[model samples]
Target: MEPDTLFVVGLALGVLSIPAVVSSVSRGERPRIATITLMIAGTMLVWAISNKPGGYSIEAIPAMVKRVLQGFT
Candidate 1:
């Protein structure tokens, strides 16, 4: 997959994991799964950012997301 796509997927996963982490904590359950998910997401995002040409800036994320979404349509 493209680095941008990977970054987007990782970002989405990381965002989704927030609810899982919250729910797990609220239920008093071990948050192992949620934690692992977050770790994996972080790794993917980091990998993508590191491998991307010219790297990326936080300010460019919105434009990157827009470009990626446009490609899907």
Candidate 2:
């Protein structure tokens, strides 16, 4: 997959995991799954950023997300 796509996926996964982490904590659980999800997401995002030419910029994210979504439809 493209670096931008990977970055967007990882970012989305990381964002989604926040609710899981919060729910687990509220329920007095260990949040194991959420923790793992966060770790993997972080790894993917970091890898994508490091591998991409010129690095990543916040300004390019919307276009990147649009391009990725277009591929799936």
Candidate 3:
């Protein structure tokens, strides 16, 4: 699987589990379906809006005076 897909899937599953665990601790709910659902939805929302930009760019650096002097005849 692609890294992005893996990330989204993992995020969804992880978000889903948070609420389930929370409810289990408080009201003794076996499954916090509502909270988990909401969290998962939120994760998807963010992922949809934000994606990795393609390609890469390199930045040029200034030549140091020391290096320039060393190369002088």
Q: lDDT tens string, model 2, 1-73? A: 7888889899999999999999999999999999999999999999999999999788888888888889889
The TM-score values for the models, in the order shown, are 0.89, 0.93, 0.37
Candidate that would win on TM-score: 2
lDDT of 3 by residue, 1-73 (tens): 3334433454556666776678777886666576666667666545633553441122211232233334443
Q: Write the per-residue lDDT of candidate 1 for residues 1-73, one digit (tens) a residue.
A: 8999889989999999999999999999988988999999999999998999899898999999999989999
What is the alpha-carbon lDDT for the whole of candidate 2?
A: 0.93
Mind sharing the TM-score for model 3? Answer: 0.37
**Cα lDDT, all candidates:** 0.93, 0.93, 0.51
Against the true structure, what is every candidate's RMSD?
A: 1.1, 0.8, 16.2
The order by descending TM-score is: 2, 1, 3
What number of clashing residue pairs does each candidate have, in the order they appear? 0, 0, 0
Which sequence of candidate numbers ranks them by lDDT, best first?
2, 1, 3
> For model 1, what is the error of residue 15's alpha carbon versus the real structure, in angstroms, after optimal superposition?
0.4
Show the lowest summed lDDT stretch of 10 residues, model 2. 56-65
